[model samples]
Target chain A: EPEVTQTPSHQVTQMGQEVILRCVPISNHLYFYWYRQILGQKVEFLVSFYNNEISEKSEIFDDQFSVERPDGSNFTLKIRSTKLEDSAMYFCASTSYRAGNSPLHFGNGTRLTVT
Target chain B: LAKTTQPISMDSYEGQEVNITCSHNNIATNDYITWYQQFPSQGPRFIIQGYKTKVTNEVASLFIPADRKSSTLSLPRVSLSDTAVYYCLVGDDNTNAGKSTFGDGTTLTVKP
Candidate 1:
């Protein structure tokens, strides 16, 4: 089966610095999403993108966060001025159909550590 | 989206059949129940999905009653490798916009 791949499997940065997490979703998928999981915590949805625009975002997705599909296959999440709280495992997911109709394919995840 | 309630943890031995149940009292008519399994440091993997009745796949089985108020995920002859956290999510087909909320999942610990 095709898989979603993420670059920089582990990222370490000082607080207040900027970080960009990159993901390559499965080919032929129309919907893309980003989620984060703090250690020992539930996975939290941050944002969803479709048609090259944001479809929905959670309150956790603040102005400090932005997502871009700079190319047809590359989806990136940029966090401006990362805080210590931003340290978590970031996961990228993609699905061929809308939520509830199809299952999402997720990348292993990028572990981001903000000091 | 509907909120789901599932156990925080469960324990079973190898070769046992494990069933994890989730409750969704406010499930909407258009909502579907989906389950995902996550190993440590890895992303959650889709296990099964169902609206009503029973849906069985190679990995597991999902049972939804007529009311759709609750669902059960059954894994048969579980092994030590089956230990993981299982998440249950409820979402509607009409307006989710590809966003799904995950609550703290049920952690399954399989012993030898």
Candidate 2:
């Protein structure tokens, strides 16, 4: 089966540094999403991208966070300034159909660690 | 999005059938109930989804009552490898907009 792939399975960064997480969604998938989970917390939605524009975002996705479909296959999330609380497991997902009926395929996840 | 409530944890033995129930008292007409499973350090994987009645897939079965206020996920002949956290989510699947709210999932531990 095709998979959603994320780069840098683990990343370590200092506070105040900029970090970019990259994801390659499955080809033919139209919708892409980014979600994060703080250790021992529920997975939280960050943003969803469709047609090269942000379709929806959460309060957790603030001014410092942005997502771009840099290419046909690559979706990226950039954080201008990493805070200690920013450390968490970031997941990328894609689906061929809307989330209601078709299921979203998720990547293994990129573990972001901020010091 | 309707709020979902599921158990915090469950314990089962290998070969046993496991059922995890979720409640969504305020489910909407367009809302669909979906379940996802997550292992230790991985992203959530879809298990099954249903709007009403019973829906069965190769991995699990979803049972929704007439009221659609609650649903159940049933895993048959479970094994130790089945241990994982299962999340129940209620949302409108027709729109590409808005994010689904995920609550703390039920952690299932299958023992030998």
Candidate 3:
């Protein structure tokens, strides 16, 4: 079975630095999403992408955060200036629309650590 | 999106059956109840989904009442490896916005 793939299983970056998390969604998936979970907190939605454009975003996805599908297969989330609170497990997910039902398939996740 | 209420945690023994119920009193006509499981350091995985009645898959079974206000996830013959956090989400198939809310899930610990 195909699976979503995220690069840099773990990352350590300094505060105020820019970080880009990369993900490769399933080949046939049409919708993609980025979600984050702070340590000991519930997973939070960051953004959703479809047709190479952002479909929805949450308050956490503020000015510093951006998502892009630079290539057909690669989806990325970039943070211009990281804050200490930005440290969390970032997950990439994708899904297919079949019979008007779609279930999210998530990658292992990228653990972002800001110091 | 409909809010869901479920137990915070549960403890079960290996080889026992585990049933976790989630209450969504405000479920809408377009809403579908879906469940996801997450282990530490990993993203949530799709388990089973159901709109109404009982839906069964290889891993678990989902039971929804005629009122559709609540649902249950039943895991049969659980093992230690079945320990994880399970989330119950209520959302619409048209918008897919319901998935955005990942409330605190019910943590299940299966001990030997």
Calculate the i-RMS of every candidate, to one decimal place: 1.5, 2.1, 2.8
The window of 10 residues in a row where model 2 chain A has the poorest summed lDDT is: A96-105
Question: What are the Cα lDDT values of the candidates?
Answer: 0.92, 0.91, 0.91
The lowest-lDDT stretch of 10 consecutive residues in candidate 2 chain B is: B93-102
* Residue A63, candidate 1: alpha-carbon lDDT: 99
Pairs that collide in candidate 3 are none
For model 2, what is the C-alpha lDDT against the true structure? 0.91
Local accuracy of candidate 2 as per-residue lDDT tens digits, B1-112: 7889999999999999999999999998998888999998899998898889999999999999999999999999999999999999888866552377779999999999
lDDT per residue for candidate 3 within A1-115, as digits (tens), equals: 8999999999999999999999999999888999999999999989888887898888899999999999889999999999999999999999885222468899999999999
Q: What lDDT tens digits, residue by residue, belong to model 2 across residues A1-115?
A: 7999999899999999999999999999998999999999999989998899998898999999999998788999999999999999999999886666567789999999999
> Who wins the lDDT comparison?
1
DockQ of each: 0.68, 0.62, 0.52
Which model, 1 or 3, shows the larger lDDT?
1
TM-score of chain A considered alone, across all candidate predictions: 0.98, 0.97, 0.96
| DockQ score for candidate 2 | 0.62
